[model samples]
Target chain A: MNPAPSSSATDAAPVLQAAGLRKSFLSGEGSIEVLRGVDLSVMAGESVSVRGESGCGKSTLLNLLSGLDTPDAGTLTWAGHPPRGDRRAAFLGMVFQSFYLIPELNALDNVLMAARMLKPPGAAERARAADLLARVGLAPRATHLSTQLSGGERQRVAVARALMNSPQLLLADEPTGNLDERTGDAVIELLLELCRETRTALVLVTHNAVHAGKTSRHLSLHNGVFQ
Target chain B: MPWYLYLALKQLFPAGRKFPFFTAISVLGVALGVMVLVVSTSVMGGFGREIRRWTVDTTGDVQVRADGGINRPADFLAQLTKVPGVVAATPFAEGVVMLEHNLKPSYPAVRGIDVERVEAVTPLSKYIYFGKLDDLDDDSVILSSQLAAAIGARVGDKVEVYSPLLIEALKSDEAYLGRELRVCGIFEIGHQALDSSLVFVTLRTMQDLYGRRGSADGFDVKITPGLDPDEAAARINAALPPALHGHARSWMEINHDLIFILQLEQNMIFFLLTFIIIVAAFSVTSSLLISVVRKTREIGLLGALGGQPRQVAACFCFQGLVIGMAGTVTGLALGATVLTFRDNIVAAFTRLTQSEAAIERFYQFKQLPAHYSASYITAIIVCTITVCTLAGLLPAWRAARLKPVEALRSE
Candidate 1:
């Protein structure tokens, strides 16, 4: 059974809901069923960590929940309704294993990119981006290019970008995968702290049990189902 | 600014960095192409303009000729003066003559002009180098500079002229000899062919030599300023009496073949030079294609962050537009700078090669000229920007086709 929710997790509406989600990939002639009939739900201000072995469909599940890929079989909703194009930027944020920061933009600009997706950034948005960078401990490196930053600093900048729009939910797909053990611990702590303080729900997908244990609830993916 | 435009600029210039090498290389390629186009088109236009000016200066704006010859010169002159748009008119006759000076024989075209009226129709006095146009009398002739140099003749020297009329006189068993006239002046019209083999004499003297009295071959007419020569010629032709059997031709019509050739050369150069911009645009396409491939994951991040496919495409499209604008502006500036010093550059080049005289002989121009047509420049700007903007479409399509999940999963 999953652990009890943190105090920040309310008995209110769930930020994300997915039922009977399924995905398949073509491998040669026949197909490989990557994901089959998964169900997941996370409440506002709650942090849920999903741990799995290699190729356990954890990333595919995240992709489905984030609506980046179409699930062949089931229904999904964001805050009780269908996902919308216009609201996507304001409704959700995503972090990746690769950091995926645009090389041309500096840390501040990279963080501001998320806000820019919603609208052209004004002074308020700029201040918020700087504040988020400071929250993630990247205030000093705000002007540094992605190439100029260390791996941990880049990941922190990505975290700041993910929260720039103040989305209701944040999906992090092994964001600390490329960093060292010490840096990875720090990134996980920062993610959990920010999510709780902002009252934003978090779905953390990772292979590290220590990182997974830090969240309010933890589930392990075995085969294509949660165990 | 929109995020896509902002990103596009950052990609090209990239904050906190020196000029990007890729951007610089692409911009320079387009700049060189545009510079060549501007310089070449301007020079070609200059050649055409200079030719037209010289032609209208040597001959009048319009030339009136008869089916046989104008039988009543004085009557025709009075009638021409009454014609609307006719500023002035002068009578003339021309034929080839064998000229001998210092025992050297040369065949040259000779024109007989009305000394009093020629100045009103054509500015022949401005071309006189050694003597005055008023010095030209029935007993005197003005030799073209090159012809005078070829036969070692100078002002006040006497030269013998043998016209075809002398042969006809001999056939009739009439005692007629070649007319001898003093060279009263030397004129250079700055045209190779005109300055090389042309002579001028008074009309009465020419009539005495050719045995054609009280007649002229044609009359050269100058029209009111700013009036179209072709329109003036048409008016003159319509006003002439059918009994005269005369027609008027504009200077443009007289040199139609030469003007056509010049226009053809200019168009061909423009057509050929356009390929350089196409080549540069292709390079831009290539670079953007590579950028799309390299930034696949970042594109996925953009999509995941709620950037629509069209917005993603705009990012790449805007890059091409920025490059084109920057290149065109730089190219025009560079072209203008180079044209300003074109004469100096040509002088240096000719001096180094020791071909100053040969260049003058071959090009028939001592100084290079340039003319910038507004229409031509506008076409270049529009065409170049369009080609460059279109260049981005393929890469943008490729970028937009990427599925966010698949792109993010790309290793």
Candidate 2:
């Protein structure tokens, strides 16, 4: 697989660029504008955090970045080209606050499942999944189902799964929201280390100022624009 | 395995978890439907086969009759027996006659069959429960047990037999003779119609009685084993002389109305029983709907992991297919077991209730009959699986149309 464009190449072209993004929702009788206009950019191997109040569209921004949802009006590009449909998942991996590990599969299978979306995993990919699980400190729990794992361990597995396909960027929406303070810090630390080791750009969305402060660049969303 | 199929299997039979209750009920529903369909089909097939066997045994495989009486029955019988599939042929004369016995008169059909050739073409000799069939002679006759009982006659009792033609002749002031025939034998074929309304006499006696010295009514032809009676009849008809204007009919054609009624009843039962399977498919639909609702977040997760909408739909469809296949196999096994032990089961019931009268009154045979047809079973399985697959489509489509963001938001 092609390595995510190197930091030198990323210096010439950012990994992701978005401008004039807008989104809204229909309330009882009126439309609620979540984001009026937003502009953001993240370079390769860079870690950025977006901190906002609840309902301020932090998750919405992450969703748009992951291509899980579409902005009402905007131009969002990955490596200078629009990410289309499932190709977005191939280019970018997502980790959710709830640690959305499929309950039916074991930890190892869950990680492998993400790889399977791009292509059928081979022996080498299996080894990489094993390595990633070990990196997340859940190697011994590889065969344990999600139901059997602790909340922190499930989150770690989710983080491991997000990097399985060697995506160029990882979009984490409140990755530590469901964990206690200490467990959440550990999960954030592990997530940061993995992203740094792989040189994958990170877009972490959170409500915690301390977690937001750990990233290289910190931005706050207010009135639908980043500050 | 493909990822979608793997996911489908995992969702259906999740490891380390008890199987879901609603899914189990759906599977049971499908199994019950398939069981009833299979059992009913087998019973109906058995009934049809038995009826056909009885009809063929009583009427011979084919019957050939001329427009009028066959003048040279011996030559016609020779020609009939020469047909490729024709195994045996017998000449017989039939007419309505009145018999006076014990000062009582009754009308019954009198059939005159050649004693030597009758045994070759029919099971009439085997059905003679009392007396000897060979004892029938010029002045003697064999009466069905029911007819004999009706007339209060027995073997060695003399009875006067009068033909309608003979009666007409006498009424017109023409010479006619009534024969004093002795009842020589009594036969019971266990067929109510034949036993109650038919009597047997020698061919020469019937010829003399009817005033046709060398003519007979028809010839009964039995085909070789495994040959279709209709095809055999057609061949015989084609070979008959144009001047004779003879037509050969299969036993089924002779009892067309009865056979048609039986077939119609079987088809209606089959159609009605299929509804059971259809109803069971509704359970499948409901169960899948529940699963879809429960797994909404997981569906969104799959979508985020790059699963196509069509693939997501296929996962649920595969789940339904597995359930259907499992039910079909179990039902087929259950049906086979039931059919194999049907007689034993009935006997046990009979013993428990101490009732044999119901069986004797309702059925013509001592044992219940079941016929297993591979083609019919295949059709049932195919139809059941198709319905089950279709049942999955609604939920599958719903799942496919789900937006990943909305689904994930539910969690």
True contacts kept of each: 0.80, 0.55
Worst window of 10 by summed lDDT in candidate 2 chain B: B357-366
State the fnat of model 2.
0.55
lDDT (Cα, tens digit) per residue for candidate 2, span B1-411:
678888888888777678666667888899988988898889878877777766776668899889898999978888888889999998989998988898888889999999898888888877777678888888898998778998899999999999978767978999876789988889876556667778899999999888889899999889999998899999998899999988999998987887788678767877898899889988898889999999999999898888889999999998888889878988888888888998898899988998765674466555677888787898899998998998888889999998899999985
* Model 1 chain A: lowest-lDDT 10 consecutive positions: A1-10
Model 1, chain A: how large is the TM-score?
Answer: 0.95
Error of 2 at B283 (Å): 1.4
Q: Score the docking of each candidate (DockQ).
A: 0.76, 0.52
lDDT of 1 by residue, B1-411 (tens): 999999899888988778698888888888888898999999888888878777877779999999778878999999998989999999998888899999999999989999999999889999998999999999999999999999999999999999998788889999877789999999998877788899999988887777788689999999999999999999999999998899999998999998899889989998999999999999989999999998898888889999999999999998999888888888899888888899999999999999998998888877787899898898788878888888889999999899888888787
All candidates: TM-score: 0.94, 0.84
Candidate 2: where is the Cα deviation over 4 Å?
Answer: A1-12, B18-20, B93-215, B224-228, B242-245, B344-365
Candidate of highest TM-score: 1
